[model samples]
Target: MRFARTRRDPVEVNLTPLIDVVFLLLIFFMVSTTFETRQALELELPETTSGAAAEVSPVTLVVTAAGVYRLGERELTPAELASALAAEAEQAREHGLVVEADGRASHADVVRVLDQAGLQGIERVRIATTESRTGETISPQAETP
Candidate 1:
């Protein structure tokens, strides 16, 4: 007597569940992530004892120690800066302007930025500064150039 051979079905892996799980994880990560916008320049801002954190502004100008000017993330020449400021003047006046100058940057350079802003009719301008470590306030009249 010969025994009959039994045929079995081929094994298949169901990837639908795996795909669904992966999709859920991706959505979870995307929803939980926080995004922050930061400037490209590296600036060690000057410190002041009475310094206060400033609110975010639509216009931000960065002045480097080498007298380089950056409007937002874009580097601008002194001449180009004037035109750029003119373009953003409306927004700057509405949302205000924040000037972030390096600790070693020249006072003239900072003044130039302020003057440009003044000419644009942006009355609300704030200088960005860090808090002093010594906890002592220095008066502007006490400092000698």
Candidate 2:
């Protein structure tokens, strides 16, 4: 008796499901991820239980109600302030900046100071704020610097 032979088909892998699952995972992560942006300076009042303080005092930049720039105790014009900051930054003190704006200081003045600080290679800049008895922060009033 003669036996008949049958042809066999080659095995193939369908990658559509794998690709779809991968894309789904990508979409899931994209949707689940969180993004935070700091559009302004962050200022937090010192708590009663705050940690130990550093020995070095940060560079102080004061914006008076009259919109004058004071680097430490010395008052400086905008141009002078920039030059002074550049010089100080070259020292590489690794200290941040403390910005204390008067209650009547203008917002523009504060932002300008911040911008200048950034340009002078200052990495950290803080806004000095006061805490009320009610646990609320009181920002300075708006006045042209």
Counting clashing residue pairs in each candidate, in order, gives 0, 3
lDDT for predicted candidate 1 compared with the true structure? 0.74
The residue ranges of model 2 lying beyond 4 angstroms of the native Cα positions read 1-56, 91-93, 132-145
Candidate 1, superposed: residue stretches over 4 Å from native = 1-52, 132-145
Candidate 1 lDDT by residue in tens digits, 37-67: 7534233445557544445777888899999
Worst 10 residues of 1 by lDDT: 136-145
RMSD to the hidden true structure, all candidates: 15.3, 9.8
Write down the worst ten-residue block by lDDT for model 2: 136-145
**lDDT (tens digit, per residue) of candidate 2 on 15-123:** 9999999999999999999878668655454444433323333577789998899887789887787787776775423756667787799998888887887787776
